[model samples]
Target: MRKSYLKLFGLACMLTIVSCSLDDDRVNFQYTPLQITGASLPDTFELGRVYTVDVNILRPDDCTLLDQFDVRRSFTDTTQIRTISAVGIVLDKDECAALNDSLQDAFQFEVLYTKPYIFRFYTSDDSEGEPEFLEIEVPVKE
Candidate 1:
């Protein structure tokens, strides 16, 4: 009887383990580009100094959360240009609310090179389906 009870307990444990699932209802997060309305940058940058750049962005819905600033630097031999864009982590759930709200966000930028830096903030696509940007140049003060 004791052996039979132990066998039954082992079968129950195996059944419980088999009934558990690793799949969840939460959908996979998608990274999407957000629209940058405007940005507040300093007129000049000082070497080895950190500056806080305020950026205004627009989101499609409340389900989208700001992931980080997609700062892509140009690897060209002549130009010191960086493209500043905002990427959002989207949670595609059923209860997500749709709204178009402008949000203000800031990021820290440190000046390393002595040359002038050109920032291209992504706004949106134009009428011809071309990417538009708000370009600003900040020279390094020596």
Candidate 2:
């Protein structure tokens, strides 16, 4: 019984040494997130006329990418909201990892009715983190 106990202890020590030597060499990094600093849109709009809004974003670094762009319109009552139509930006993997750290992209959409509409810009990063938004009011005129 004593010999068996010694063998078990010796095996356990060898396993521990082997495990300690198998450390990973890869480094993990936490990057700064992308932020929507501000937005620019027309103070008023005419019904059926298309308008463009320029959205300014502050990126962390060149490696940061714009994962998604969701432009939505809502009412002041907070009971109705609808997504505005936009030609989705198609970018390759290389293009997404751009060298620039800031961007001013334009989103085009039209309004059908005149009221107090709230325009919201929802953006995400390549890291798939929670999105940041820029909300503004664009009143439609008759």
Top-TM-score structure, candidate number:
1
Could you tell me which 10 consecutive residues in candidate 1 have the lowest summed lDDT? Answer: 73-82
- List of clashing residue pairs for candidate 1: none
Which segments of model 1 are wrong by more than 4 Å?
1-13, 75-78, 127-129
Error of 1 at 117 (Å): 0.4
lDDT to native, each model: 0.90, 0.59
Candidate 1 local lDDT, 71-108, one digit each (tens): 98883565489899999999877787878889899999
What is every candidate's alpha-carbon RMSD to the true fold? 2.9, 10.8
RMSD of 2: 10.8
Estimate the overall C-alpha local distance difference test score of candidate 2: 0.59
List candidate 2 segments past 4 Å from native. 1-33, 73-100, 122-133
Residue 71 displacement (Å), model 2: 2.4
